[model samples]
Target chain A: MISDITLGQFFPGFSPIHKLDPRTKIILTTLFIIEVFLADTPLLLALMLLTTVIMIGVSRISFAVVLRGIKPIFFIIIFTAFFNIFMTKGQGEPLVHFKIITIYKEGIIRAVFMGLRVIILILGTSILLTYTTSPISLTDGLEILFKPLKKIGIPVHLFSMMMTIALRFIPTLIEETEKIMNAQKSRGADFSQGGLIKRVKALIPILVPLLVSSFKRAEELATAMEARCYRGDKNRTKLVKLTYKPLDFLWFAMAVLLFGGIIALRILPGHISPDSLIYDILFYKV
Target chain B: MKEIIKTKDLCFSYFEYSDNDNVNQAKIDVHALVDINLTVNEGEYLAILGHNGSGKSTLAKLLNLILTPQRGNIFIDGQDITKPDLTEDELFDVRRKVGMVFQNPDNQLVATIVEEDVAFGPENLGLPREEIRRRVNFALNTVGMSEYSGHAPHKLSGGQKQRVAIAGVLAMKPKVIIFDESTAMLDPRGRKEVVDIMEKLNREESITIINITHYMEEAARADRVIVINDGKLIMDGTAKEVFSHVDELHSIGLESPQGRELINELNKAGLNIDTDALNEDECTEAILNKLKAI
Candidate 1:
C-alpha cells in the first residue's frame, strides 16, 4: 500500500529535464510559479501552457503520469474554483442574479482563470521536479545549497544525514504499514468493512504495532549511528558532493527565457486573460 | 595474556511502567544481568551459552555501551567505558574498538547494497574514499563475501546476510568483535560457514571474539565457555570443564551435546564409557573404542 503511493511522485527518466540538477529544477519550479501568477493576459497564460508542454515533452514522461500526480489535488482545485465564483463581487451584470445570490460575469471569469493557473502550477512542478529528479539527487542538491550553513555551525552534514535516513526509511515504513495491515486483517480486524469511526478504531491494532516497531527501529538506528562514532556537526565530509554540469545550465537558461517571455507577453497591450475570454466567448454569445 | 575487555561486578536491571500516570504506580523489575564478572583476552575466541530470556544479550548490549551498567564498570583495553569524561563521541571510540554483530541481520543492516553496507562504518568514520573502498574490500574478503559485494542484502540468504553484517563491522577494524547470537537464525550449512569465518578472523587477524550463542556445539568450538541462567553467571571454564557437569547444566534448563548426553546415560547404566566427546567425530571414535573394549 505504501509502495503504491509515491510520496515524492518522481518519475525516473533519462530526458533533458531528468538530467537537470535538482537545485536547478527546484529553482525553475519556483520561477514557474512566479511567472504563472504574473501572467495577466490569455496570450501569456497560453505561453505558460506552451512552456509546460515543452517541459513535458523534454521530460519524455507520459502526460498521464502528470495527470495522475494531480489526482489528489483535484478536490482542492474544484473547491477553490467554487469559492472564487461565488465569493467575488463585480460591477454590471450577473450570470445567476437571484435574491442575495449574485454570480457576476467577472467572478466567473476569475474563477476559470484561477482554476487553470492552479492546475498549470501542479502540472509544471510534477513534470519538472517530481517526475524527473531522484530524491537522493534532490537531497544532494539541497546539501550543496545548504553547505554554506556549515560555517555558521548549522551541521549541514548531519541535516543531510537526517534527510538521507528519512528517504531511506520511507519505503521501509510503508512496507511495515502494509505488513501491519495484513496482520490486522488476518486477525479479523475489519478496517474495510466498518464506518469511518469504526474503521479508525480497527486501525489501532495495526497502528500500535507500527508505532512500536518504528520506535524500536529508531532506537536501533540511533545506536548504529553512535556506534559509527557519529559526533554531531563537526569535521564531517560527504562521499558524493553535488556537481553542476552543462545540462543543468542549459535547463536553467531555458527556464529563464520562458519566464521572461511570459512576463513580457503579460505586460503587452490588447491581451486578454483566459478567464475573461472564456466568459466573453461563452456568456456574451447572444 | 593481553586483556581486550574486562567487566567488574557488572549488574543491570530494567525498570519499566513507572512512567505511566496511573494513580497506582507499578514497577516491572526485570533483572536482566546480575553480578557478571568476566575478562576476554586479546585474540581469544569465547562463546556465551544460554537459552532464550537469558542475560547473554543484555551482556552483549552492555559491552557495546548500548546499555549502561547500573552497578559496575566495563573497561575496554584498560579504558573505562562507563566513565563520565567519555562523552557519546568517546563511546563511539569504544564502539569502533569493539565492533558488534547483532542477531537479526535484517534489522542491523542499513544499506541496500552489500558493498555500501560494508562501507557504512568506514564512511561514518569520515575516512578517505580510497581507504573506505579498501577497507570494504578487505572486510568482504575476510567474510568470504567479496563476490556478493554487488548483490542486495535482502536477496541474500540468512547466513550470507549475517556474513555481510560481520563484514560491515569488520570494516571498522575493531580489535574485538561481539557476535550476539548471530548464527542462531541460519541453517546448518550457513551456521558452519559463519563459524568457519569467525575462526579465520580470530586466527589470521588476531582479533578477540566474543560469540553469544545457544548451540552447545558452537560453544564447544570456543577456547572458553560462559553459561548464564536467570541473569547470573552459573559457570565459566574451558569447554571440557563446563560441559562435564551434565546434570548441573540440565538442572538449569540447559541442553548438552547429544554425545555428552549419551555418555551420561551410558555411565548411569554402568558402562565404562568416557563422557568427554566434544564433537561428533570424537564421539564416533569413542563409541568405537567402547565397542572394542566390549
Candidate 2:
C-alpha cells in the first residue's frame, strides 16, 4: 500500500538531466517552480509544461512514472479550478445562475488558467528534481545550501544529520507500520468497517505499539551516534563535496536564461495578470 | 604486552525507571557494572562472553568512555577519561582512540549512502577532504565493500550494511574497536561476514579487538575469552583455558562450544579421554586416537 506513493522516488538514469549536479538540479527546480507561479496565460503555462517534458525527455525516465509521482496534484488542480470558477467575480453577465451561485464567462477562463498553473508547477518540480536526483545527493545538496545558515547560529550540520537519518528511516518505519497494522488486523481489529472517528480510534492498537518502538529505536540510534563520535556542527569534512563542473554551470546558465524569458513573456501584450482583473473592479474606470 | 585499556575497580550505576505499582518510587539504581578490574593488551582479539543482563554491553560502553565509571578510573592508552580535571578535549581524544560497532546496523549508520556513512567518522574528526576520501576508499576496500560505496545503505543486505558500519569505524583509524554484540541481530551468513571482517582487522591491522558476545562459537575462536556474570569479571584467560571450565560455564547459563561439550561428555561417561579439545575437528581426531589405542 505504501509503495504506490512515488513522491520523492528517484528513477536511475544516464541522461543529461540525471547527470547534472544535484545542486544545479535543486536550484533549477526552485527557479522553475517560481516561473510556473509567474505564468499567467495558456501559452506560458504550455511553455512551462513543455520545459518539464523536455526535462523528462532528457532524463530518459518514463512520462508515466513522473506523472504518477505527482498524482496528488490532480486533486489540487480540480479544487483550485472550481474555487476560481465560483469565487472569481467576472466582468460580464453570468452565463448560469442559481439561488446564490453564478458562473461567469471570465470565471471560466480564470479557472482554466489557474488549474494549468498548478498542474505545471507540480510537474516542473517533480520531474526535474525528485525524479532525477537520488535522495542521498539531495541531502548533500541541502547540506551545501544550508552552510550559510550556520553563520546565523543555526546548527546546519545537525540539521543535515537529522535529514539523513530521517530519510534512512522512512522505509524502515514504513515497514514497521505495515507490520504493526497487519498484526492488529489479524487479531480481528476492524480498521476498515468504521465511522470516521471510529477508524481513528481503531488505530490505537497500532499507534501505541508503533510509538513505543519508535522511541526505543530513537534511543538506540542516539547511543549509536554518540559512540561513532558524532560532534554536532563542529569542524567536519565530507567525502562527497559539492563541486560545480563545467556542465553544472552550463545547465545553470541555461536555466537562468529560461527564467528571464519567462519574465519577458509575462510582460508582453495579451498576457493578463490576475491583478488586472481586480484592478478594473477596484479604484479604476472599467 | 602493552596494556592499551585498563579498568581499575570500575563501578557504574544508572537510574532506570521501570513501570511498577509504586510510581513515585520507581527511580531504581541499576548497577550495570561493578568493581571490574580488566586489562586489554594491544593487538589482541579478546572476547567477553555473558548472558543477557550480565553487563556485557555496559562494559563495552565503559571501555569506549560512553559510560564512565563512578567508582574507578578507566585508562585508555594511559589517559584516564574519568579524571575530574580532564577537559572535554581530553575525553574526546580518548573516545577517538576507541571506535565502536553496535548490534543493529540500521541504528548505527548516520548517512544514506554507504560511502557517506563510512565517511561519517572521519568527517567528524575534521580530517582534510582528500584524506577523508583516501580513508573512505581504503576502509571500503578493506571491508571488501568498495563497490557498494555509491549505493544507498538501506538497499544493501544486512551483512553488507554491517560491513559498511565497520568501514565507518575503520575510516577513523582507531587503535581499538569494541563490538558490543554486533552480530547478535544478523543471520548466520551476516554474522559470518562480520566475524571474518573482525578477524581480518585484528590479524592484518594489529588493531585491538574487544568482542562482547553471547555466541560461544565466536568466543572459542578468539585469542582470549573473559566471562562476565552479575556485573563482575568471573574468568579471564586463553580460550582453551576458559573453555576448560565447562561446569562453571553451565552454571552461569553460558554454552560451551560443541566440541568442548562432546569432550566433556566423553570425560563424564567414565571414558579416559582428555576434555581439552576446543573444536569439532580436534575432538574427532582425539576420539580416533583413543579408539586406535584401545
Candidate 3:
C-alpha cells in the first residue's frame, strides 16, 4: 500500500510556524538551506543547529519527525562524511593513520561538520516548508514565486498548473491503481507468489488498465477544464491571493537577521570559511 | 417561453481515432447523434431518454459545446455555436451559459480541495478573489457541501463527489446545466441525492436542466421527455402524453416507470383509469376512482 507514504506531509496545527504564509516559509527555507552549507566553522554549525532547535520548538513537530525526513537519504550524508574523512588530506595531527591511509584530524573535523551540515539542511527544509505548509499552498507559493519566469517565455503558470493537477490526481490515480490491482488479483493473478520477473509480468494486467484509466481521466479533466472556460492564458485570476501579512514579515525579518549574522561572521577580520576554519582549528599549530 | 438551449438539425459522429483516450483500441465509425432538433426553454427540466449508444450523451455534449456538432449548430442564450469567426473567448461565453455536470464525479473535478474545486469556474472567469470565494461559499451551501469544503476530493464518497461537481458548475451561475447521465455511476442513495439536487435546481432556482439518462423513472419525473434511439429522436412529449405510449417506449428498449406500467396495464384491461398517473399515490387514486364508478 502506497498510503503510508508521509512524503510532503504537513502536520496540521495552529503553531506560529504553521500560521506563517507559505511564500514566506518557502523563501526562508531557501535562505536556511543556503546558510546551512555556508556555515563553515564548528561554531557556525552549532548556531545553525540552535536555530533548527528553536524553529522546531515553534513548529511543534516532534524530534522523530525531523529525523524521519532525513531517514531515507541518510546514506548520502554518511557517504559524504566518509568521502571527507578519507580524501580530505591536510598536514595535521593524525586522528587515525592506519598504514598508508592517514586519516588526519582535519579530515575528522570536516567529516563531522559535513554530516551536521546535511542533517541541518534536511531538518530545516522539512520542518519549515513541507511539515508546516500544506501542499496546495506550497504549490501556490511556488507559482507566485516563479511568476517572473513568464517574462522569459517560460510559461510559469503552465508549470504550476501542471503541478497542481498532478498533486490533485495523485490520490485518485493511486485509488484507481489499487482497484485495478484488486480486479486483476481476483482473476487468479498471483502478484505475491511470483519471482522477480514473473511478478513484473503479473503487473502488466494492473498497469495496462491503470494506464488506460489514467488516460481516460486525463481526457475527462481536459474536457472539464474546457467546459469551465479555462483560457490557458496569463489573464486568469486565482481564488486565494498570496498576501504577505504581518506574521509573514516577522518571519521574513528573522530569516534576514539570521542570514546577516552569518554573513557578519564570515566577513569578520579573522573569520574564514568553514573548510578553512576546520583546517585551522585542527591542523594549525598553536 | 424563451429557449435557453436550441440545437437545430444537430449531427455528430465519433471517429475511431478522434479522441486520444480511445487510442490503440478497435476503431469504428460511431454515429452518436443524427439530425436532433431540440429546444429547451428557460427554467424547464427536460430529460433525454436513451439506452447506451443511443446518442443522448452526444446531444448533451453538443448543448454544452464540449463537442461541436459536425453537421449543425447549437444556439445557447442566442449565440450561434457554429459561427465561423467565433473567438475562443466567445466560445467560453457559450460554455458559460450552458454548463455541464458529467457522469463520473472523480473525472469532472480538477481540484484537490472541495471549495477550490467549486471555485474553479469563477477563478477561470478571471473574477476577483473575494468574488470567487463568495460564489464558492454560496454554491457549496446550496449543495449542502459546506461542511466538506476543506475536505479532499479523493476522500469523499461518490454522492459527495457528484455534489461537489454540481457545485463546481453551479458556481459559474450558468442558465442551463446538462447532466450527461450524471447519476449513472452513483449508488441508489447517491443517485437520489443527485436527482433531488436536479429537482431543486429546476424548481427553486429556475435553472434549465437537460438530464440524459436511460432510467425511465427519472425521465418520468422531468417536465418533458425526449426519446433518442439509434441516433434518432423518435418521441418527445410531457410525461403524461409520453408514458401513455408504453408499447412504443418498450419497442425502443425502454420500459415505462413502475407507476406508468400499472396505469397503462389497467387501461389495457378496459378499466377506466387514467394512464397519466406518474406516482404511486396518483395511480392508486385512479384505480379507486375506476372501482367506485363500477
Candidate 4:
C-alpha cells in the first residue's frame, strides 16, 4: 500500500520537454510558479492555465495522471477556496446571506482565482519538472545550480550526494518496512483496528526494527563506498554532463516572455482591468 | 609471479565499549586479526575460508585499505600502505588498484540507475566523460547486464543486483578484486551466478581474485585456500592439501566437502576409497572403479 506513492515520479518519453536540459526545466518551473502567483486578472489566470495545459500536452503524459498528481492536494485546494469565500470581505453586494454568513461577488472571485492558482501551480511544476526529468538529473541540476552556495561554505555536493543515496534507498527501505510490518502482523499485532493513539503505538514495533536496519545499512554502505575509492566530491567527474542546448535557450526565451507579459499586464493602464467584462462573465458576477 | 599484495605481522583490534555506566570503564580491545603473514600473487584465484567472526573479513578490509592495521604493514603492488605519511592521493591509488565487491548488493549500489552505478567508480577517479562512459559500457557488457543498463536496480533480482555491484567494481579496472562473502546473502542460483563470474574474471581477464566464503565447494574450485580461525592463520595450502585435514577442520567448526566426507565414510566402512577426490564427480569415479574391481 505504501508503494503506491507517486513522489518524484518520472514518465519516460522522447518529447521536447523531456529533451530540455534539467537545469532549464528547473529554472522554468520556478518562473512558472512566480507567474502563477502574479496572475491577478482573469485573463492572466486563463493564460497561465492555457500554458499549463499546452505543457502537459507537449510532455505527452496522460492528463489523468497529471490530475492524479493533484489528488493529494485536493483537500487543500477545497479548504483554501472555502476559507477565502467565507472570511474574505469585499467591496460589493452580498451574493447570499444565511444567518451570520454573507458571501460577496469579490469573495467568490478571489476564491476561484486562488483555487485556479493552486491547481495551475501543481500541474505546471509536475509537467515541467518531476514528470519530465529523472530524479538523478534533477539532483544533478540542483547541485549545479547551488554550486555557488558552496563558496559560502554550504556543502552543496554533499547535499546532492545525500539526496542521491536517499533516492536510491527509498524503495529498498519501503520494501523492508513492508516486510517488518508483515512479520509483526503475523505475530498478532493489530495496526488497522486501532484509534489514533493506539495506531501510533502499534507503529513502534515496526519503527524500531526499521531504524536499526537503516543504521546497519548506512554502515555497510559507507564501507562499500570507501572501498570503491569515493573520497567526497574532490576532483570527481560526472559521466553525464548537463549542457545547455539551443532548445534550452528557446525555453528560456519563452519563460522570459511569459514573465514579461505578466509584468506588463500588471503595470499597464486601464485597458485590461481586473473588474472588466471578461472577469464579470467568468466569475458569474451577480 | 609478481606479488600484488603482501602482509607482514598484521594485527587489528576493535574496541568494544562495555554497557556499564561507570565513568572510568576500560574499553576492551577485541582482536579481530593477529600476526598474519600472507602473500597474493598476480592473477591468483585464492579463497579465504573461515567461519563467522573468524577475522577473514578484517583481512580483506586491510588489503583494500578500508581499515588500517593496528600493528603491522600491508604492501599493495610493493608499496607499503600502512605508513603514517601516505598521502590521500597515494591511498586513493591503492584503492583503485584493489576494488572490493561487498556482500549486500542493496547497500553497495549508490546510483538508482544501473549504468550510473556502474560508472560510479570511474567518476570518482575523475576520468574524462568519454572514458567514464566507455568503462561503464564495458563493465556492464562484461557482467552480461548490458540490457539492464537503463533499468532501476531495485527492480532487479538479487543475482542481477549482485552482478551490477560486480560491474560497479569492475569499472575501475582493478588488478585485484575481493569478494568479502559476496555470495552469503544470495540463493543457490545467485551464488552460482556470482561464482561463475569470479571464475570467468580470474581465467579470461587474468584479474586476481580473493574470495572469502564459508562454502567448501567454492573453496574446492580455487587454486589456493587459506583457513583462518580465531584471529589467526591456521592453514594455507592447495585445495587438496587443505581439505585432507578433515579431522582438524571439524574441530574448528568447519566441514569438508561432501565428496571428501563420503570418501572418509567409505574408508571407515572397511572399503578403501581415494580421499583425494574433493568434488562429487571425482568421488563418484573413484567409487565406480573400486566397485568394478570387486
Best candidate, TM-score-wise?
4
Q: Considering lDDT, where higher is better, how would the candidates rank from best to worst?
A: 4, 3, 2, 1
Q: Write the per-residue lDDT of candidate 2 for residues A1-286, one digit (tens) a residue.
A: 9744543677777788888888888888888878887776566677787887887787888878777766766888888889989987877689889989999977888888777677777777877788788887787888888789878888876777777788888877777888888888888888888689999999888889989988888998888777777778577676777788888999888888888887776555444554675434321211
Better of 2 and 4 by TM-score: 4
Q: What does candidate 4 score in Cα RMSD to the true structure?
A: 2.7
DockQ of predicted candidate 1: 0.27
> Which residue ranges in model 2 land beyond 4 Å of their true spot?
A1-7, A41-43, A86-103, A181-202, A265-286, B17-27
Q: Could you tell me the lDDT of residue A200 within candidate 2? A: 92
The residue-level lDDT of candidate 1 at B204 comes to 96
Off by over 4 Å in 3: A269-286, B17-30, B262-274, B284-294
What TM value does chain B of candidate 4 have? Answer: 0.96
TM-score of 4: 0.94
**Tens digits of per-residue lDDT for model 1 on B1-294?**
988899999999998777676977888898998888898889899999988898998998899787888998899999998887788567778889989887766677766568877877887777887888889999999898999987766568888988998898999999998898889888998899889989999999999989999998899989999999999999999998999978899988887777777777877898878658788788778878998989
Candidate 2 C-alpha lDDT tens digits along B174-195:
9999998999999999999999
By TM-score, the better pick of 1 and 2 is 2
**Segments in model 4 whose C-alpha atoms lie over 4 Å from true places:** A97-99, A270-286, B18-26
lDDT tens digits by residue: candidate 1, A56-100: 887887788677877899999899889888988888878897897
TM-score of chain A for candidate 4?
Answer: 0.88
Candidates 1 and 3 compared: the better one by DockQ is: 3
| TM-score per model (chain B) | 0.95, 0.95, 0.91, 0.96
